[model samples]
Target: GPGCVLGLFTNRFFVLRGYDMKTYDRLNRILILLVILSFVMAIPAFAQTPSSDPDEKAYEEAKQDAMGICPPIFLRDENGNTINPVSRVNADVPYSPKQTCGKCHDYDKITQGYHFNQGKGEKMTKNFAQTYPWCTSPGQYGGRW
Candidate 1:
């Protein structure tokens, strides 16, 4: 009687058509086993420490060294004139970052970097060319957005 009641309850609420109690029990056991396996697999990921890669270690050290030692910045205009905010003559002109930061940094070399270039002259793969016919390069500059 108890087995019949349980079967009726499972069938009514769970709507497990054509599956007997044994099949339902097996499915439950399989689901439980899969959940346990997932947790077991994730343990190694949770236990991981910082990376041992040389490049990553160097990047971290450099980041730490550069944290709070920045000097005051002097904003300069396109013609290498210092932009005094209260001055009337060059007050309206926009300060050029290339002229300002470029005093210490190389503008040409920095703009030639991967991010700024954005695949402007890179060769496209055959599959990518075929798939995206409008694209001339792999990145945003020459490729269709």
Candidate 2:
């Protein structure tokens, strides 16, 4: 009797330690639950949702499919005005994040002595965030380029 009981319980012990019949059924339920959880976790990758953010997703989808992508970020043009030219994102170059044109002016605070004067059709202007009537456009945001 002892040998039979030990043999019968040995596999159950190894597979689902300390579980009685009812508890073993519950343990099996949990194993199934874990498998289901893993299955659900894999769904998002296949969904093929937009890129990093909604705007980015919109930009890529609209690049040619719907409305065109918003014109590329502007840099200075022939007459010193910010002009948006058609340029593809350079995959070969390193990526840098730039939100506003003024963000390009790296040495403004240090180069106060050489403030660039506009000598062309477009006048150069800058905005300090603290100033009132502040504009969020490229030049208005302290854009350097």
Candidate 3:
């Protein structure tokens, strides 16, 4: 009797030319067993328990839930007005990133960061992974923005 094979693979028909039904069933069962084994083996890699101790893991989870996450606070301008630039519809008008961001954060401190300085002038002790060609000379790693 010729029939469709359905399980792990697609509903494909194996031609029963010389092979019997018993052999086909056994092969299908083997394929299903292999798929199940593969899934079982891959479970440990995906299911990370974080900590070894169950109590500690539970405590860490509970602490995260208890502490919770802070909601984003909508910032206001110096005039006590809510400064939402997204609401403004203008094609010609261009807003400065520094001026807009400085309302909540210090823009001056951000300009003095590592990226601002020239790559050749700086003397860095740490080895940066990305700066391979430029900083390979001596003691250098930082890049110019």
By TM-score, the best candidate is: 1
Candidate 1 structure quality by residue, lDDT tens digits, 41-67: 999999988777989989988877776
lDDT of each: 0.74, 0.47, 0.57
User: Which segments of candidate 1 are over 4 A away from where they belong?
Assistant: 1-69, 86-89, 119-145
Answer with 1 or 2, whichever has the higher lDDT.
1
Ranking by lDDT: 1, 3, 2
Residue by residue across 1-145, what tens digits does model 3's lDDT show?
3333344333233443566557678887887788799999999998975787899989988878866753344444544445555675342344454555666678788767665443546455555435554553333324322
What is the per-residue lDDT of model 2 for residues 13-42, given as tens digits with 9 covering 90 to 100? 644655556655565566667778988999
**Local lDDT at 117 for model 1:** 76
Task: By TM-score, rank the candidates, best first.
Answer: 1, 2, 3
lDDT comparing candidate 3 with the true structure: 0.57
Best by lDDT: 1
Error of 3 at 65 (Å): 29
What's the residue-level lDDT of 134 in candidate 2?
A: 36
Residue-level error in angstroms, candidate 3, position 38: 0.6
TM-scores for all candidates: the values are 0.33, 0.29, 0.27
